[model samples]
Target: MSAIASEVLISRLADWGVDTVFGIPGDGINGIMEGLRRNADRVKFVLVHHEEAAAFMATAYAKATGRIGVCLATSGPGGIHLANGLYDAKLDHAPVLAITGMQETSVLGTGYQQEVHLDRLYEDVSVYDQMVVNPAQLPALVDIAIRTAYARRGVAHLTVPNDIQVAEAGEQPYQLVAPAKPPATAPVYLPPPVRPRDSDVRVAADVLNAGGRTAILAGIGARGAGRLVEQLAVALDAPIIKTLSGKMVVGDDSPYTTGGIGLLGTGPSEELVEEIDTLVMLGTNFPYTKHLPEPGKVKVVQVEIEPTRAGLRLPTEVPLIGDVGATLEALLPLVTPRAERPLLERYQAKMRDWREKMAALENPERDPIAPQYLASLLDRLATDDAILTCDSGTIATWAARHWHIRGGREFYLSGNLATMAPALPYAIAVQHAYPDRQVIAYPGDGGFAMLMAEFHTAARYHLPIKVVINNNNSLGQILWEQMVLGYPEHGVRFGNPHPDYAAWARGCGGFGVHVTKAGDLETALREAFARPGPALVDVAVDPNEPPMPGKVKYEQAKHFAEAFLRGQPHKASIATTLFKDKIAQLKES
Candidate 1:
């Protein structure tokens, strides 16, 4: 008997080195499910509670491993559920393939139950979107889809009809021309890393050498170029400011590093950006143009692998189009090292002062639990090589400011997408990818509640993931935004009766710990980390603790005052908590 098309598809995926798939099974996809079962030894299918979680898992897997991550779902609602996660992958430029099932080809246009126009639905999010109409088309379609996804570094989608999947491989008719040979089998090909032109590199180097004080803004594109960046910074005597997505690329211990820049940036980094004459950007397209120094004030040189991304955020004096590591290797030899070291020293001193100020704020004496203290404690306790995932919100801000990257640690987040609820799925994927390494997820209350069912997914897989919940019981980031914008916090508040996430984790067959006091946080974290399976540690933190901007503009201060005068409930408390320690420093200044 000949193999079914679905079986052939699964075998091809295994050939492409896809050992694991994340998805839920449905009747519409029974043929594909059988294929998975038949190939169970080669490829494993993880059963997630929701299709959305499966998509998120795939995105996380792709982000963690620089390979194509696959996710499957049945037609209609199951396919619809995948949109959010797929969007996450699309925006973040993670390579992923979404295989969604469809009704029989005959029923596709006849208004049948569970029928969705998945091809049209996924078109916006996918780089390659196609539906297999015949059994013979399966192999070629699957091959193209996977290759396109990998080459484009984005989402590829295939909607396989149930009828076509179960059909025999050789049963379908093929169109052949008389006296013509069969088409040659296409070989698997991977895209090579791009290299910048020598002239472009020389121009960028010249821009850097011409400036007295240069600053290097590194992003995720610079992941493998850490040593090169460090060398370049040393040669130029420059301060290195990392974008949030590229925080782990350079270790915090590096003498030239001034930490993250922009909204969740350090004072030293923000000041350095303002004073630098030359700004060299690597691999990051940081969206906040306002946070960057005015274009005319600073000469900009950007290096990126993707041609379109170069100079998209800010005006570039020299756009070096190439892989970050390769471009830096070429540029380093051309640039003249700066002789003066005063600017670098000034920034380093400011960085030290900023760290000391943050240390003071991380005190355990705060009445309501200080998130900074918890983040710092986690940073201290987490393994040196641990992988950390953070959700979008105040927890992200806390992690950005407090989680010290000491070289080996890996951090993942929804960079361009900035989506919420990715922490759990990302942790799950990371744990699955590197079972021996410690994996941690930090999600705020709102983000955690979005995909709370994934706790069961973790237990089912027996994934040993540590999920630390920043339980502020409010959409802390949004609330802060509202206050800064002069709007009263109306819908931002989460009314009492917040679900106990730790208890929910236990209910899902995982260990759980709830810590209400700051003193007990470390103990609870230690206990949770010791669990053999997944564990959740819910720590109650102050909801009013704002993630203050690096530079508070006059408009922001005016709006904040307006909100306070309008009788915002927590305004006074939040204000005192934010500025009390800074008053003495302000007086001295």
Candidate 2:
């Protein structure tokens, strides 16, 4: 007998270099599960507790390794559970493939048990969504789905009916058109990289050359163009401000780097944006419009691979549509180097003073552990080539400000989607992709609780990911937002009977430790990292510590004061403890 269609699908995936898949098994997908069992040596299947986690793992895998990540799920609820994570991949531009099982073709519209409109449900989040109605469509449909995902840099989805998956693939006329090759001799597909036009490059250089003070705002799209970006920054005597997703593009130690821009950014970066005569944006469509300099105030030149996103965020005088590295190379020779460096030096000095103030706040002598202290300690202890995944909320703020990215370290989060609870799943995926490298996760109490079951998934596979929980026992980011908006905090606090996450980790067959004091943080982190399997270090942090905006407006100050006067005096104490170092600067202003 010839190979089953499901087996052929798995073989095609293996041909494209997909060695691992993340998902849970069910009767609806039993055919695919059996195929996985038969192809166990070629492709490994990771059984996650929830389909959402599986989708997240796949998204992270693609983000970490520039390849198409794969995930599978059964019909009905299993397929529906993948929506959130699929949206994460969609918004963040991660290449991923999601395969969901369906009821038999005969029963698909008959209201069969566990039936779901998988194709319709996934349409919004997928770049290519299709349903396989016949066995003859097996390898071709699978191939197209994977290729579309890689080409579009988004999610590709396939809904395979249970009966079609189990049927023999060579029974139809279409199968005879192209004979099935042996599993070991399948073909592979690779998409070509896009390049920029010569005219666009020259136009960008002209815009930069005309400006008196130039600034470069880099994003994740400039990932591999570090050397080119650095060269451009040096030649122009421009200060570089990174978007949160582009934080790893320039190391914290680089003289030209002024740090992240936006709400979770530095004052120096905000100042640089305001002072610049021209803004050269690269590889990032940063969503925070208000945080950017007024569109009318500065001349904008944007470079992006996707032409549609070139000037979507800001009005541009020059939109260079091409690969970041290639465009920068072409634009470099046409531009003249600037001799004056006053603007760059001013921002660098401001950044130096800010770093000094942050260092003063990371005192180990403090009673309750400072979130910044924990993040700083983790940064010091992490390996030179470690991969860090941050969850949404206050944890993102702590990681953004304190987790200094060195040259080799990688840091990422839900950039456009800004979804919570991705830290653990992302860590698990990266650990699986690079078993020899270290993977660390920073998840807040609220985000961690959302997918806490994934801890068991890590232990079951012996992933050895280190999870650091910023246990503030509340929706800390939301609470601060309320104070800034002048709304009294309500329904934001978590009640008693707080979970002992460290103990939970132990129960899930991993090492666990809880640290309340700031002094014990480093030691606990060391012990957790030394463990052979998964580990969780839960650190109780101050719930009142706020993530300050880059520029505080007068209305924001008035609202903050109003919140404090309206039965929230704790905000005053928290502000004093957190902003004491900046008090001198405030007084001067």
User: How would you encode candidate 2's per-residue C-alpha lDDT over 503-574 as one tens digit per residue?
Assistant: 999999999999998878888999999998999999998777778876677898899888887877466667
What Cα-based lDDT does every candidate model obtain?
Answer: 0.87, 0.87
Candidate 1 per-residue C-alpha lDDT over 1-589 given as tens digits, one digit per residue, 9 for 90 to 100: 5688899889889888898999999987999998998899999999888888889899999988888899999999999999999999998889999999999988778989987899999989999999888777756677888888988889999999998889886345455564333233343866775878888888888788888778999998899789999999888888899999899888988888999987898888888877878898998889888788887888999987777888898888999888888888888889887667777788888888878777776767676888888999889999999889999988888899899898589999988888889999889988999999999999998999988899898998899999999988998999988888888888887877868888899999999988889888888999988888999999998888878776677898899888888879886778777775465345434
Displacement of the residue 108 alpha carbon in candidate 2, Å: 1.8
Q: Which ten residues in a row have the lowest lDDT in candidate 1?
A: 178-187
Quote the lDDT for 265 in model 2: 89
- TM-score (all chains, Cα) for each model: 0.96, 0.95
Each candidate: RMSD: 2.0, 2.8
Off by over 4 Å in 2: 173-187, 572-576, 579-589
